[model samples]
Structure formats: structure tokens, C-alpha cells
Target chain A: MGTIGDLGEFALIATLTRRLPQGPAVLLGPGDDAAVIGAPDGRVVATTDVLVEGRHFRRDWSGPYDIGRKAAAQNLADVVAMGARPTALLVGFAAPPATDVEWAERLYDGLAHECRAAGASVAGGDVVAAPEVTLAVTALGDLGGAPPLTRAGARPGDAVAVRGRLGFAAAGLALLAAGRDGPAELTEAHRRPRPPYAAGAEARAAGATALLDVSDGLVQDLGHIAAASGVRVDVESAAVPVPAVLGPDGLRHALTGGEDHAFAGTFPAGAVLPPSWTRIGTVTEGTGVRVDGREPPPGAWDHFPT
Target chain B: MGTIGDLGEFALIATLTRRLPQGPAVLLGPGDDAAVIGAPDGRVVATTDVLVEGRHFRRDWSGPYDIGRKAAAQNLADVVAMGARPTALLVGFAAPPATDVEWAERLYDGLAHECRAAGASVAGGDVVAAPEVTLAVTALGDLGGAPPLTRAGARPGDAVAVRGRLGFAAAGLALLAAGRDGPAELTEAHRRPRPPYAAGAEARAAGATALLDVSDGLVQDLGHIAAASGVRVDVESAAVPVPAVLGPDGLRHALTGGEDHAFAGTFPAGAVLPPSWTRIGTVTEGTGVRVDGREPPPGAWDHFPT
Candidate 1:
């Protein structure tokens, strides 16, 4: 098979979803007009993200498989960020006429790989011809009898914490942008993000007041927590953990760069932080996020950066 | 702001989702790590479609608003085809760095327009910078006491029927491709598809045996039904109602042209077809689709035409 135009939309989708594992949760799968997933809890947590070629990733920097992995990972992370267990994923892929079937298969392999890692599966998707490679992934999750942790739940006197690596993806991105091929760790981070999925569940179980995934810069994302929770968040710069492998600039990269996919949460005062997580800041009686008792620079990952 | 690169991802999404009406099903809307929607029925119907610039629509031929409407229409149509009531839509948009913010807003306006038409709402989505404009929309729906209508339910004695216009969109596409400024009706069909939302519910209520949307040509989609349902579908060209507004070649366009987004279904013999739906064919023993007792031409809307 060659380009999507040649394979056509239905055939392309059939080829892509052929090998995916089917589970009971999928009442209806790919060959259908729509996919039916078991929500069970009377509520489904859904989120969508789009990745465009060139802007999101370069074919030269990442292979088709990497792109698929990144697309699934990011969307699945969104479900996890809601303190839900990802159950299914629906993907939409648009690619040019000259694209190869092998490339698409590789991309699906990556998607399947990540979904398996997240204990979910690729349920269904649509394939269409486009001028560039674009991926839209929607993740559906089950809340597992727990109320969703929202940004508005944090209160004053809450202890702020983080789970998983911070700024490693950003460091990897910087390395890639600078054309510096250094360590395998950095390259892997950029190619496939390993978000702290378990931490989201852990935080929910721990009675976290507010929870969020650090996809944007830490300071900026904290500001969202502050704004939504109606409390000020103060991060102690020195206390914020940085990966040893990232060197001195790692902290800054983690704090400012986006796409780390780490989990950040607030717990009631005197609550014991999980051993897997590190204390980064605290919730206080105020509004907005502050770093070391001062306002950090505005606009960390604003889409319309001014 | 010029281009998605200029505004960045976060800011662009913030601007687009701001002030948009979030339906009751959206328990947690945008601004969080992920969105939480009220599934209510313990199952969620999900589908995704991606539209790329140039391949899906030429910017010169379609305004940003038209593109947005088309994108939302196609995905929501899938949910409806499965006998689900569309509840929420998640959009992912990718555009070049120099694109104007106003252009993005216009696209959202178009998306909102279609969502409103379906009695659905745009819940949340992502904005990313890319070299070309790309849209990925995922639609969520409620089945509401009805089992999903899949392609595998057709029986040998079932009657084939269709709701909504056929071939008009394809006729419009042909006119556009030929550079013929035809009637406004044809042009509107190509730019914005109007799928029969209520008809999907009605079909489910009326006990449709098999169902699908006419997106990739009637003959081809019917073939899918035939293959999936283990039955032969014979479509009578004369019975397949062609919209009169499509002019002389309307029947041909309707037969082979795609993107109508009309609901095509199979009902048991003597079953009452829903209002506005016309009988087009009948399900028979065997497999594959035939037109007027003969094998139809193979290349009609085949994405990978031989």
C-alpha cells in the first residue's frame, strides 16, 4: 500500500486497526460507524490532542513510530491527569498521498505500544489524505469509583508535590533543537514520554486536593492550579527536584519547558508525601503562582505568546 | 496574532474555548489537565476524523469557518450513524506560525455552529503550531437506552433506506473541481454537510438492522455493510433518490461521489421507513454490493483507487 489516497480511508483504517487487541470494554470496535466503550461509572473522562507534522515533530527527528507513541502518550496522559484509568483510545490520522503504508503501520505499532503500556488499546480511528501528517488522539477513561481530582480542589495550607521526571523531555527537546546528540536518555525522552501514570491514581487515593499534569512549564501550570483553586502557590526553587542527568540548566528547562507530562498535586497540610514524589512547593492564601516568594516570568507556554 | 507559532499552543486554546457554552454533560471543561464528561449511560460512543488542508479542503475554496464546520460535521455524523446522540466535541487544531488569531477564532465559530445544530457542544481541544492547517475532532455521544447500530446487523430480507441528501456534496465537489460556478445549493453541500441527527435516533427507534453513514460513496459504504453483515446489497439506481437541485448529472454524482454524511440503513421487510428517508435498495443473500443486478464500477471514491 502506498499513500492514504491509494489505500482509501476505510481500507487504511482497516489496515491500521487490524492487529489491535480487543477487550470486553469495547462493545463496538473499528469496522463500525462508531466505537462503543464501557464507561461503567456513568461518567467518562475524555480528552483530545492534535499533533501536526513539523510543528509537533520533524520526520527527520522522529520516525513514524515515535510520532504515534508521542500522540498516544500525550492523550493518555490527559486521561491520567484526570485521575482516571485510561480504557480506550481513538485516533485520527491525516497524511499526504506520497506517504508509505509501512510508515503508517509503524506509527500504529507505536500507538499500540504506548496504549498497551498504559493498559489500554487503540479502539478505532479515521484515516484521511492530507498535505501533512496530523494526528488527533482522543482518550477515554474510567474514574474507578473515585471523584475526579480537579484544579479547583486545592485549598490553602496544602503541600505541593510532583511525581515523575521533570524537564527531561524539555531537556531532550533542547538537545534536539540545538542539534546536540548527547545521551540516549535525552533522546528517548523527546521521542517517547513516560508519564507517571501510577502517580495520578496514587494522588487520588491519597486524597489530593488538586491535581494536574505538568505538560506546560511548571510555573505556568502552577498558576492554573492557583487560579482554579483560588489559592496562591509558592514554589521553593531550591526544593524543586531536577534530574541529575540534566545538569545545572535542567531545573530551568523543567520549570520553563513544556511536554514533560509529570504529575503535580496538592495535599492537605501535614499530609505525608509519597516516597515516589518530591516536595516542590506549597499552597497559600493568595492568588497566582510565585517562585521563591516572587512572581515568575509570565507566559511560559502560552499558545499566543505575547 | 499571526500564525499559531506567534501565539503558542496554550494561549490559542484559552482564547478559543473562552466563553464557549459547555453543555451539561461536561462535568469538567477545559483548563484542566483533562476534561471530565458525564457519560450517564455507562457507555460512551466515540469517533474521530481528521481533516487536512489541501487534501480535505483547499483554503482558497473554503473559508476557515467552512473548514471548521465541515470538520465537526463529519465526526459528529459518525456518532449519529451509530444511533447515538452527540454530546460533546473535542477539537485539535494545527496551523502555521503566521496564521492570524482571528482566523482560528473564525474556525471555532464554525465548529460551534455545527455543534449547536446537532444539539452538541464543543467541550475542549488542543491548539498546536504546524506547517499546514489540520483539524482533528472527536465526538462523544449518548446511546440513551439503545444498543449501538453496527454494520454487521443486516439480514437478507432487510430493506435499504437513506436519510439526508445524496450525491449533492459529490456534485458540489465535481462542480468545484471543474471550476464551474454552479448553483449555490451544490456549493453549500460541499462546504457544510448537514447530516440527519434525529433520523439516526429514529432509525434506532424504528429498529434499523444495519447502519452506516455515506461518507465514501454509497456503493462503497454499502459494500462495507454487505461484507460486515454477510449479505448482498442491491441498490437500484432508479430508486436511489438524487436531489433534484444537483442538476442533470446529479444521479451519477450521488452514486459515486462521497462526503454526503447521510445515514444509510437496513430495515426488516415491511418495516416503516422513517420520515424524509427514501427506499434505495434491499438486502439479499450473498456478499458484496451490486447496482441494478450488476457489479458496480470499482473506482468510485476508493481512497486508494487502482
Candidate 2:
């Protein structure tokens, strides 16, 4: 396959954008200095995330497609956590010119796949040369007139609930670090997370008082909710749902391993819970996260770990 | 000042977001998962650009403030080229953990300064650790109920016009590449471009048929308009404005140097040109860009330069 340098910049963009499907939200896609996307509700919910090659993902350990999918999944999860439906994604991709063009195509393929899965489209993007591969993803969403479910809305006596799977990615990371063989499914979850795309609206409709995307481990993410809401979040270790695939360390992974992308929220006591969600804890007047009224261990994913 | 690692991700973000002005367009600012910005017109015009450390800008050549200003200026220009007024900006910055927090704070100051000059606000952003410094900027604009002026709208018999200074950045770059000391003014222009942000609406209101931001040299950008509109763009070399600083090579810089970020557009024949715009060329029945009835030199900025 020819390298990106051989194909040139504009030609490479043409190759990457040619086959991607454009959704109704995108009024203008590519071929221009800017893109126009519909914001039917007269407002836009925006979020951005950047994934660097070595710091965020190892090219040797994950395929381009998986990396692309994971990048899109994480950004989309941010919009969903705010109780909005993602409308479009704008990607900024940078890589060495010597890299094969096929790699870029596969990476974009993964991005397209994830966007399609989320009912969103890749509206526009920028491609450039850099010393290391990187992806900067920005997601735009529509609220459909509902107030955004922020992390500060939870109150004392609220019930904390979670929707979707957790812990598989952490366990998969353990296996990868140890060079131990693990189930294909566990490793796959680590490579490409499957966040419940529709669960955010479900939680909002059920009157979620506070919400978060479980990207930095359940306890760590909930700690943000606790700190922001000035409420103590106490979880029952047994109530925390850990995938059976992680074996005995499932609970540990559930508590500290990041990138599960599950929906976690707090609702008014006695409010009906969505079928996808399970009550895991209770909110009380205090500060910070707790496990059975005790302090939890000190392990959560930090971008710049001390 | 402490390094970004010592400050940590959350603290770093807090320091960067603190005191930055949030305009009325931003319903929600940082410290949350995402930001909510008013779209007003039920549609949004969006664009993103990534600036890598070595490829886009050199840390040694430009101060953090200048870098930040340049980044925001280029992105804001993209939105203005589409005849939309920029409303908000979301920035994603990545750098080595050892980077100074003061550096990040200054970069954001530059971003805020430029955004305010363009009548926009900093809505939300992400900061992460990377091996090299990189910036990914996404700009959102509102059409205010006006139909978007696209590059494909130009027709034969249209007059091509350009607003703002041209070739200064290119000449500035030439001075820098040769290690020759040029006038401080010329070098500053290369460091930071001042695009005429308000002129986009003025051109649109004056019946501009096609519009473009001349980011990649006049000939190169106008080529895009010609290709999209299926018409020939013939520039009059004598009519093209060249900055006086480049001495005898002013016309060369005007024709081939990039990053001027001047606004170029096509208007119907006999249409009164906006006072802000100066006539530079004419559109005719044909394809491709020509200067003074001949093909211009084959030099324009490309990310993956061969």
C-alpha cells in the first residue's frame, strides 16, 4: 500500500471520506472550509477528547479500527451522559506521513462504525502530519428541549443506579499487562467498548437527578458526582455489578479500572428505575464516595498518574 | 509554577477555565462533562483544525500566547469563510506531563483574547498528556437565518474579491526560514494573522455568491472555489495586493505563500462591492485558477508536503 506522503493531503482526505455515510444531521460534509449540521432544538451540547498514540493506546497492542471505535465511543459517551443524543462528530487525525494510507482508512472505518452505532454521523474533520499518531474527537448533541442532566443535581436520599456492563476492560488490561491469555470477549471489550447508547435518555426519562459516564472507574466517576452534588455516595460492594468474565478480581476492576463507559446516575428515592439500571447505592448528606460507609481504596485512572 | 503533572488534570483544567469570559452564547461552560451553546437559528456551522508541535508550529519560534492566538484565528477564519458569525470554541490541548501549567494558562489567555476579538467565547475543552504539544480547536458559528454562502455557489461573470491583508505571513515565513532578520512587523504577522472577522457577513450581505478563507495561498484556495463551482477564476496580478514589507518578492508571496487567512469571495457582475473588499479577479466559464491569463507557480502549503 502507498504511504500517506505518496497519496498527498487532499487525495488522502478524499480516500478517507469517500465511503462514509452522511446522516441527516449533516447538511454539508467535507469538501469545504467548514460543515453545517442541524441543531433542531436551537442548542448544541459539545464535548471534546484527545487520544495520543502511546499515552492513550499502544499501536502495537490495538488495531486502527479498534482505536477509532474506542475514540468515538468515549466522546459519544460524554454527550450521552449529559442526557443528549449525539448528532455529529468532527475528527482531527494526525500521523506520520510515512504511515500507510490503509491504516488511516481502517481507523476512519472504525470511527464511522461507532458513529453509525450511535445514530450519529462523521460531519467533518482535519488531517495533518505529526510525529506521533493522535485523534482529537469533538461530539455535538441535541437535547430535544430537555434540561441537561448535570453532575450537580443529585440530592441527599437519592438512589444511585448504573446501566450497562463494567470491569471487563480493566480485567482485559490486567491480562494484557501480564501477557496472560484471556477470553476473546474480555479483551474485545477493552479494545472497543460497547456503551449503551440509548440508556442516557432512559435514565433522564426516569428522572435521573445526577448522571455520569463511567469512564474513570465506577467509584472515581461517582466521586465526581458526590463532590459536585455535595452528597455522600455509599455503594454496597456486593451490589456493584462486575462481569463474570473478570473472575475473582471482578470487583476490583469494577471499582478502579477505567473505560467501561457504562451509564451511572442518581435518582429521587422511590423513583422507578429503568429495566437496564440496577440500584447500587444511596446518596446521603456528606461529601466524597464511600463503600458501605467506609473509605474506598485509592486507585482510579488518572491521565497523568502521580 | 508547578508542572502540569504536579497540578494534575482536573486542577489544570480549573486553572485554565478560571476567569475566562463566557459569552451569552454559552449556556454552560467548563467544570461539567460538556458545554451547552445556543444555536439560535436551528443550525450550526462547525470546523476543526489540529496543530501539531513540529508540523504546525515551532515552540522555539513562537511564544505560547502567539501560538494560541494563531490557532484560534485559523479556526475562527474557517467559520467566517462560510459567512457565519463564530459563537463558541472548544479547545483540546495535549502536551508532555513536564510542561509548565503557566504555559497552558498563557496559551488559553491568547485563545480567549482572539475569541473575544471575534465576538465568541471559550465554551469547553480537554487537556491531556502527550509526548509533543498539540492543539485541536473546534469553532462553532451561527448563520443568524441567512443562507450559508458555499464555495459551489459562484457563477461565471462573477467578480472575485478579497478582504484583509495578504502575503505578509508568507513573507514573514521566508524571513524566518533563511534566518534573516526582517522587520519585527513582518515577523509578527507571520506569528499571528489578523483575519477580518466582521467582513464575512458584510460580503454575504452584499450578495456574495461564493466565499473562501485564503488559508492556503490565494491561488490554492481559489482553486477549491473554481473546482466546486465549475468555473474559471482569473486573477489580475496587478490588482492583487501584496504587503509592502516583502520588497521585490511581494507579488510572489501574494501568489504562493499560505496562512494569510484573508477572505476571498465571488459576487454577481455589476453587484456593488462591499467597501471592505477589493476586486482581485473575475470568474468565467471554465475550470481551475489562472493569474493574469496564465497558470500560477505550483507552490502552496500542504500538511504532508512531498
* Candidate maximizing lDDT: 2
Evaluate residue A21 in candidate 1 and report its C-alpha lDDT on the 0 to 100 scale.
Answer: 82
* Candidate 1 CAPRI category: medium
**Could you tell me which 10 consecutive residues in candidate 2 chain A have the lowest summed lDDT?**
A176-185
lDDT score, residue A130, model 2? Answer: 88
lDDT of each: 0.84, 0.90
True contacts kept of each: 0.81, 0.83
Backbone clashes per model, in order?
16, 0
lDDT of model 2 at position B143: 91
Q: Mark the regions of model 1 whose C-alpha exceeds 4 Å error after superposition.
A: A1-8, A297-299, A302-306, B1-8, B303-306
What TM-score does each of the candidates earn?
0.95, 0.99
DockQ of each: 0.64, 0.82
- Please provide, for model 2 over B51-119, each residue's C-alpha lDDT reduced to its tens digit, 9 standing for 90 to 100: 999777888878899999999999999999999999999999999988988888889999999999999
